[model samples]
Target: MFTIRKATVADCDLINRLAQQSFPATYRDILSPEQIDYMMDWMYAPANIRKQMEAEGHVYLLAYNPGEQPVGYVSVQPEGANTFHLQKIYVLPSCQGQHCGRFLFEQAVSYIKSVHPAPCLMELNVNRHNKALHFYEHMGMRKLREGDFPIGNGYYMNDYIMGLDI
Candidate 1:
């Protein structure tokens, strides 16, 4: 079984470590090694994680097994009236077949529904070639459009923006 807990700034190191392991594991096949390294430092740096939790209005939830080892995590931020942006969602590669992603995604939606009760929707950007595309579709999200977001240092995120009605 797994348990979900709200993550605070104190969890920055844990989140960063998890991202370091999970991000490359997930994207290694789809993205270049340089790109993956760039994105990891850009998004999952401990300082960046801290800023996200403490100042960016992002809510992060962590999923752990009985041994207290983090298995997955998700982050969401309110983007404006009636819309929340799903900034990040990752499950350890070793834990992929265990429904950890589903549990985290469902928990994220549930938490958002409870706190912001409205006919809201959640949006997320998934890599165009990410295998998780089907997973998100299975969870009732539809692709809205495609985007090539320039992150920095000549890196661009080729993504499909997907949305889920709440």
Candidate 2:
């Protein structure tokens, strides 16, 4: 139902807006409001997103329906020569039931394949308490490891690192 396009620096603010819409809702049940706000500002602020595109090697893919109505987004960052990290993937709340998540996920894999045609590793860290953990598992990712990583202000991301070979 949506077309995927590579996001540019100009779309950083839009990406931040989308994150503001999805990130808190995704973590609401598992995280405190303070932590949510902290992460939102830390990871999704427009300046941070701009830096992710400009300085880091992250490549964002935005999903839009007809007339450029945004539906979802996913980002892949190359790590080393044979591995890619899925840094972010989300479907807007309004589009949750429409299977956009799977679409975006497959698109991410496809994007990775396009860039590294040879077999490579794709990894993502999912919150241990997040329901999406099962989604990642069902999509054929296996838990590579788990860890509690400190972010700042006494907050930690208790996450399961999952991986798939592509």
Candidate 2 vs. true structure, TM-score? 0.97
How do the residues 30-104 of candidate 1 rate in per-residue lDDT, one tens digit apiece?
989999989988889999999888899999999998798898899999999999999999998889999999999
User: Whole-model lDDT for model 1 versus the true structure?
Assistant: 0.93
For each candidate, give its TM-score against the true structure. Answer: 0.97, 0.97
How high is the lDDT of residue 45 in model 2? 89
The lDDT per prediction is 0.93, 0.93
TM-score of 1: 0.97
List per-candidate RMSD values in Å.
Answer: 0.8, 0.9
Q: Residue 35 of candidate 2: its Cα lDDT?
A: 99
lDDT of 2 by residue, 22-74 (tens): 99889999999999999999899889999988898899999997667998899
Worst ten-residue run, lDDT, model 1?
64-73
- lDDT at position 120, candidate 2: 98
Where in model 1 is the C-alpha error above 4 Å?
none
